[model samples]
Target: MTCTIFYTTAMPNDRAQVSGTAPRKPMRWAVEYLIKTPDGRTLVESTKTIQRATFEELRAIMDHIIGAIGDEAGNIASFVSWRATARGGRSKRRARR
Candidate 1:
């Protein structure tokens, strides 16, 4: 089996607003990962958000996750399905509110 892993970082916009009167918190960044099969099918895709101060920590975490997934091909589908179920649950809860 062949696969490719892609990573990207997203920076927060300058005009973001917070809900309270307190000063806005430091910028938080998002690290996104995309795992794709040889035929261009996406196996797993997810993003992890972290404060700027923890950028290096987030990078390390991303590297670990990528390494583990690369070492275990069989777990890709399971990860994707689990994410789907979790996402569905969140959406259902939002819809009920």
Candidate 2:
């Protein structure tokens, strides 16, 4: 399954939750990606939403938008999003599993 992530306008309720996570530092997120929980319903970090999505659909969005979006970032860290390593992340588990 693939996941697609996109930026959305920060909602009123979103502000409080986001702030709580990375307190004492300025926070900025361009988008939000929603994923379903194991129970088969939609969840937004713990907040449930009626919107539902399939993995393939989200994957397409990531490829088209996110995969090519950032590199020389003007806003955040290298790890905030997934990145394809030039030579792989030098993994031990990757060799085993």
Candidate 3:
């Protein structure tokens, strides 16, 4: 199996800022975890949406995924949506595995 990590910075609500109230800080981050088979079919996904996550919380999520999926979790295929960035090293890691 392969693990894919999708994460982005949380955005503050606009309404709070427009209402002249202090905008509540959103969780520092948001993330989705997915596991896929070698043939490109999704196996399982996180049921709970992580819209607000601290760095520690994200790490905990990663740990859980790793425990569930084994060492394959260490070879993550990460994509950063905000920056339109994708890691090029995923193929190398997959090859190693």
Candidate 4:
């Protein structure tokens, strides 16, 4: 199975993917998500979340958000992603008995 991320600038009344579909929300909250690839590029899987949204009213709204998050990282804040590849790959090793 596969899943996708939805980005919203407006405070999410809730995380419900679509109002009529998916489980409803208990309380509305301001929430947004930004997904970047290990290469520091925005992933292309984002196009899949536009199923029921209106073209004009709904905007991706993440280009600016990405820059903001990067800036926040420079400021050194928690949950702030400075770079996707901050933790590089580890050296391969064999298990020992």
lDDT of each: 0.38, 0.29, 0.36, 0.32
For model 3, the stretches where C-alpha displacement exceeds 4 angstroms are 1-31, 44-47, 50-53, 70-97
Q: Which runs in model 1 stand beyond 4 Å of their true positions?
A: 1-31, 47-53, 74-97
For each of the candidates, the C-alpha root-mean-square deviation to the true structure, in angstroms, is 13.5, 16.9, 19.6, 17.1
Model 3 C-alpha lDDT per residue in residues 1-97, reported as the tens digit of each score? 1223433323343111111222133243323444544445444443444455443355565556545563554444332121111111222245544
Model 1 lDDT per residue over 18-76, tens place: 22122123234444555655455675454554444232343465556666876776444
lDDT of 2 by residue, 1-97 (tens): 1222333324343222211112122212223444332344442332222123232233344445433333323323222232111111122445544
TM-score for candidate 2, residues paired by index: 0.22
What is the TM-score of each predicted model, taking all chains together? 0.36, 0.22, 0.29, 0.22
User: Lowest-lDDT window of 10 residues in candidate 3?
Assistant: 14-23
Name the better of 1 and 3 by lDDT: 1
Between candidates 1 and 2, name the one with more favorable TM-score: 1
Clashing pairs in 1: none
Per-residue CA lDDT of model 4 for 5-96, tens digit only, reads 24343335623233322212221122334445445555222222223322222333334555566575552322222111011223458899
